[model samples]
Target: MKYKKYLSILVISVLIVSCAKNPFTGKSTMALVPNSQILPMAFQQYDQFLSENNVVTGTAQANMVKNVGQKISSAAERWLTANGYAGYLKDYRWEYNLVQDETVNAWCMPGGKIVFYTGIMPIAQDEAGVAAIMGHEVAHALANHGQQRMSASQIQQVAAVGLAVGTAGSENAAIYNQAFGVGSNVLGMLPFSRSHESEADKIGLTLMAIAGYDPLIGARLWERMSQQGGDAPQEFLSTHPANQTRIDNIVKWAPDARAVARKFGVTSFKN
Candidate 1:
């Protein structure tokens, strides 16, 4: 009982001290690890990834990746600055790379390292589609989703250790630990990830709109994605919002995105 009390206090203390504000969501979030430590490691890993992959350069597709990344990132900056968070991205070293992989994936790592897989380009079909994808990927970075994910995992591990210690000498200690492992992942972590994805979708829509791309294309892109016909796990067990849910959200959020873009003098949206 004393161990459990101490564990609870420790968790509470850590939670209070490890919180950082998410600019996009305006929510206090766990940030167990600081960016100073995480960014260097992320940059190194990103560099290593580029070295290991077939990085396409000087091609039209490569240029497009760079171009869309720039526009989306600039839009993010404009929004931040207008909102009085100027210099918020000073530490971010933005780099966009096109990789020769046939996977319909694009991701932005911490501190603005982005990679777009070749297979997604055909699905994008045009520069506007590319901007939608780019805005989404960049939104993940801008919103610090990577940092939050790492922090959540860190807390989960620490809590697991606390549970193990608190359950020590109990007759059902092993059973308790096993249950915690499964419960924490399914109940805590998966939901955290899915929330981040949804938040990214919202912020990305605003970004693409401010960058002069039609935010509705995020849904159109996903409509094509849904037609790709692969078996996916149930939404409750998945890290991303279900396809139809995302489409509905994008459709619903389009008017709000345009309203935001209008604040930045962007009245025209590309089709």
Candidate 2:
């Protein structure tokens, strides 16, 4: 019976790992959570978050946030449709908000709930900078990085549980505990977080270019971000890639993104 249970888990894990594809790169991906389960939950949580937060209203910045979001969302739609994935965003409830906050950060949750903190405005420097950030956040959602991370986490939990169960009666309890700690901390979290950041950077550039925002500006945005270093670790040591690495990758990938944009009649973008 125990062997049967383990076999079932192994089969389920294999199935979960097989059921994903990278939206931007068209690569096979590992995701355990189905979109049907993740999307509705993401939409509900986004709505609840907006209702709870002090979202800015009737302000120029807030309006710009919405405008940029709409542009990027449209760009994503066009790309998806052109790539034979039309209606891919049908379940996405896109919403953009400029929140009253002092943190120099921005993010988009799955299902297209985006928030721009007021403090990041200075770093944004202009409409293009805002677009750059918006594109990146939207890319994270489009690629379903959050869902992938969540799924990976679930797998990690399963592995940990299996380990604990298998060693419950063993004399190597301390070894098992140590292995679980190391596996969950290193194998489960850090690398997954880093991969999400890098994927977002790549997909974000494509989205920004498709939306008529210069993809090259992505590197400049990160340079400015690097200068505003606070208590936060340099991007390299954190979950994100280092500023230099990100800039280099953006510079390298911008031309390809522009080629993609050109297919959609975006030959040039605002500097």
Per-model CA lDDT versus the true structure: 0.89, 0.84
Q: Candidate 2: where is the Cα deviation over 4 Å?
A: 1-12, 15-18, 231-237
lDDT of 2 by residue, 1-271 (tens): 4345545675676666745676686876666788888888887887787788789999999999999999999999999999989988898888989989998889998888899999998999888899899998998888888887887778777766666665666688679778777866666577668777888888989899999999999999999998985676655346777788889999999999899999999977987
TM-score of 2: 0.90
**What total of clashing residue pairs does each candidate reach?**
0, 0
TM-score of each: 0.95, 0.90
Q: Total backbone clashes of model 1?
A: 0
Cα error, residue 270 of model 1, in Å, equals: 0.9
User: lDDT winner among the candidates?
Assistant: 1
Please give the range of 10 consecutive residues that has the lowest summed lDDT in model 2: 1-10
Model 1: runs farther than 4 Å from truth?
2-16
